[model samples]
Target: MNYRLLIQYDGTRYYGWQRQNSTDATIQGKIEVVLSRLEGRPVEIHGAGRTDAGVHALGQVANVHLTERPAEEIRNYLNRYLPEDIGIIEVKQVSERFHSRLNASEKVYVYRLATDPALHVFERKYMTPCEEPLDLGAMKEAAAYLVGEHDFQSFCTKKMKKSSVRKLEEIRLEQLLGEIRITYRGNGFLYNMVRILTGTLLEVGIGKLSPEDIPAILEAKERQKAGATAPAQGLCLKEVRY
Candidate 1:
């Protein structure tokens, strides 16, 4: 049977979602270890997205094939073995052909920024701290330019070999009590796309980049033209939509 899983993890310790030869301390590797033990054989699991190291996820999705087992038991069994930082939120049977990555229709990522000078010890792992005040209006204007479908080469990493053209369904910015939350909803995102976008928007918000310059920046398609990439800790995979 094909089972779909909803996962949540604090990626601070893991070496990203994909298994790595360098380190067995990965989200996928850890889960596969438990699954392999449970099935008494190799059990391959597929995730909806490969979140970068230090990035968190609240609603990550994955799928795996397993011999008939109670979904609730599987969830509880995995939780017993999986580390405290990683969890399986939900599990259910799915069509044999359903693939987590290929079947995803949309994804939402949010970046959190702490604008205060005094850092919260607990939030240090989840938010990026910015001491400077940001111009929210300017950031909003710059975000509007990025709403439609465009070649996001400027916002993507230069190492990306795939097509940079992607549809950005929405970019919402909200400030609450000194914490700035930037939400991105899109069909898909290139490598480090959200972090770069947040960095560029921060530049605009802090008077370093003009909101009017966004159009020209998009047209340039040069990675150097964009701002620095924000830290990975600030990014979170909020949800994956099918």
Candidate 2:
């Protein structure tokens, strides 16, 4: 049976989601160790997406094939062996054909920014702190230009082999007490796409770039034309829809 898992993790100490032979300190590697021990055999798991180091996830999904174990028992057993920072929120049997990565229909990611000079002690690990004030209106205008389908080559790293064409369904920005949250809902994202876009928007908010420059930037299709990539700690995989 194929088991689907909803997982949450604080990625601060781990290397990343994908397992690496060079390092075993990864989310996937850690879980696989526990699962392999439970089943008395090697168990391979597939995740919905590979999140970078320092990136957090509240709704990460994965699928693993096991021999007819009770779902609740599997969840409880995994949780018992897993580290405190990683958790299996839900688990159930899925169809043989249901894949965690390929079957995903949409993904939502949120980048957080702390605008206040004095950083909140607890939020420092999760939010990027900005010393300068942001122009919210200008940032919104710039983000509007990125709402439709386009080749996001400018916003992605050059190390990617996949096509950069993607449809962005929504880009909503909300400001709370001392923090700024930018949420991205899209069919898919390229390598470091969301972080790069957030960095560009921050440039616009700080008068370094104008909202009118967004179209031309997109047209450039060059990574150099975009702003610097934001830090990974500020990014979080908020949701994945199948």
Best by lDDT: 2
**lDDT by residue for model 2 over 1-242, one digit each (tens)?**
99999999999999889999999999999999999999999999999999988899999999999989799999999999999999999999989999999999999999999887365778788889887989999999999999999999999887557778999999999988788999999999888899999999999999999999999999999999999999999999999999
The global C-alpha lDDT for each of the candidates, from Candidate 1 onward, is 0.93, 0.94
Quote the lDDT for 137 in model 2: 94
lDDT of 1 at 144: 97
Off by over 4 Å in 1: 117-119
User: In candidate 1, where is summed lDDT lowest over 10 consecutive residues?
Assistant: 115-124
The lDDT of model 2 is 0.94
